[model samples]
Target: MRLPRQREAEVTPLHADAVRALIDAAAPRFRALYLLAASSGLRQGELFGLEVDCVDFLRREVTVRQQLIAPDDGEPYLGEPKTHESYRTVPLTKAVVDALAAHLEQFPADGVKIEDRTDPRKLHHRTARLLFLNQRREVGRRGAWSQVWGRSRRIANKALAATYDKAHAAWVRNGRTEGREPARVEVPDGASLHGMRHFYASLLIKHRENVKTVQKRLGHAKPSITLDTYTHLWPDEEDTTRAAVEAVLGDVPPLCPAKSA
Candidate 1:
């Protein structure tokens, strides 16, 4: 049987305000989470699974440690990053630092002091002491205290759905959906938080970053994937290509040199 090849996923970048609006509509916890995911290019689970220790406010860096996984007939488990290199430290922007700092303040802690480090796994287990804890923590459920990992995914779809409905209503009122509320904007298909990662790569390429730097920032298995995937964003070659051909042919006409002389 011939199997159909899957099409490449379509990714659209959300404007800063649109992202802010989306997060604003969500609950407080999910709001902070959404901004982190959109800004940092983290996997959905990574956002919920993140610990305060993973963020380095002064250094402006965040590390990916463990992720949440769902298996049939079992509770969610925290596992290592997708690949060895997947465990990476990404540079943080001013917005991210401000958001995280505000979040930490909003959810005040007891006597715990926040640390500056990466290693998602180490931070995951250590996060048990954080002020923002899973609901299960309140009831004393085993294997559930630090498992707020599913929280973001639970709200991402709903928030996106609300955004869709708002745009739909605008279309009903106006002859054409224009301005910020377009008739439609492409959101990634199912299981495609990876598209957000692609969005980050696009942003880097648009800024004219070198391939090796982008690769290191993304923590890809190697530089090849960075070059192969984002090559389209790079500027096209110059007209020297045609000049090379003209130069080579200029030395000789259609006939041989002896015949021409």
Candidate 2:
């Protein structure tokens, strides 16, 4: 369904199983990347720019540090966030913590190395010493270690597209039809990596988490932005809230009363 431009959008929640399937299909690097984005509401650049140092397991927080910036050639560079709001800390979940831990084990602190079979030196010369590097390494060699903002964005976009395609195909194979026609595929309407952030926000609200808490988690410039965007997700709980409010407003009229005989 198309949303009105004037209306702020609420994040739509995906089924738990579907969410898991999506994450699983993105396996290896992309899977971990997907979890971080969905759970933390991190922008693509912010996620790609994360370093090992950014994770604070003891504190259960991930600090906002550098992000990937404009890339020259196939490499990406490190850069500061565009705005102050974009630079904010994120609280993590056990799933996120576990995903990160597993990612570290697979990738390690040493990083993915780049190699040039023809001229190893040339490959080393191109690699940028950024958080997300080419998943290949050239031993005893160093590259330029520039920034990788653009490259990271490209990678994320491609990965997201691939996921949608896979999901679409799976839907078709299951004999799901769109409308009255036998559907060839079922693609989500305008689903993007950012949609995952919306999913995260809605999840928090569903759990009765405070708007301010969601605001901080999403690093919005103001709490209003969080409230405006997600208020629709919550129903008017006036009847339920009345009892609680009456405790403080003792002078208030009774929310419900017995009928007169």
Candidate 3:
């Protein structure tokens, strides 16, 4: 049986400059959210479900223990990750550590109550030291974070637009305005909070990390899944291959080193 083609995941990974712009535009409470996404490649739910205990600054790692599931009928609650592999830990960069630390300083953990899904009545209350909280001061919900993300994204996009306008003005002065206007490359389209994971994958591939390494970090069930998701992000191999071969072969000694005279 044939399955219908799935729509491609719209991905527009933010570059360093665009990311920095978003960071500059974001408030202190939300700064860490963006940084952790880019640095760790965690899913939105995993980030939302984080407890105060999940972060280990000393270890510079975050444990993906569970997720906060939002349902239509009842209040959101804690649940296991999408897969068993999704329960793995992810290492953090220095930037992510700093962001998280600062965010904690400003916004201390709150004792928000979420139901225990394992319970039959769904009446069990567990105290969650949620990272981001909603306007009701509860753990941040999907809509709340989505709103914040959208605002920051808009600010960054506007900055990109201003930059393009400035460039176009200069181009016109130089008598080169007849062609296509400068591109708004920094402006990403429809890339939501989840897109940060894609950006993180690109970063790993850009630094020449291996597929298996990315798989482990991303908590993919298998290597093929990692490849299927991010094969395009891997750098061109021809140049690196040539350089690798030449580095070793070029310095190799002749079949026999010349005998001393």
* Candidate that scores best on TM-score: 3
lDDT of each: 0.59, 0.63, 0.80
Worst 10 residues of 2 by lDDT: 138-147
For model 3, the run of ten residues with the poorest summed lDDT? 115-124
TM-score of 3: 0.79
Give all TM-scores, in the order shown. 0.61, 0.61, 0.79
Q: For residues 1-261, write the lDDT of model 2, one tens digit per residue.
A: 987778544556654444455566563655777788778888766776677788887776787765655344443445666567777888898878888888777766564333222232443322333344344532211233212222333454555666667767766777866433322222144555676677788888888889888887887889888887888886566576767777889786667977799
TM-score for candidate 2: 0.61
Ranking by TM-score: 3, 2, 1
lDDT of 3 by residue, 22-98 (tens): 77667667778878887899998888888879999999999988888887666798887887788888989888887
* Model 3: CA > 4 A from native: 1-12, 118-123, 167-183, 239-261
For model 1, residues 1-261, the per-residue Cα lDDT tens digits are 988987564444544443444466545644566666766777655654466687888999888775554445654445666667778888888887888788777764332233322454464323333424343332122344223323334455466667788877877689665655554432333423455566677778778888887887777788887776677676665769778988888677475457544
TM-score-superior candidate, 2 or 3: 3
Q: Pick the candidate with the highest lDDT.
A: 3
Q: lDDT for model 2, please.
A: 0.63
* Superposed Cα deviation of residue 146, candidate 3 (Å): 2.8
Q: Residue 249 of model 3: what lDDT?
A: 92
lDDT of 1 at 167: 78
Stronger candidate by lDDT (2 vs 3): 3
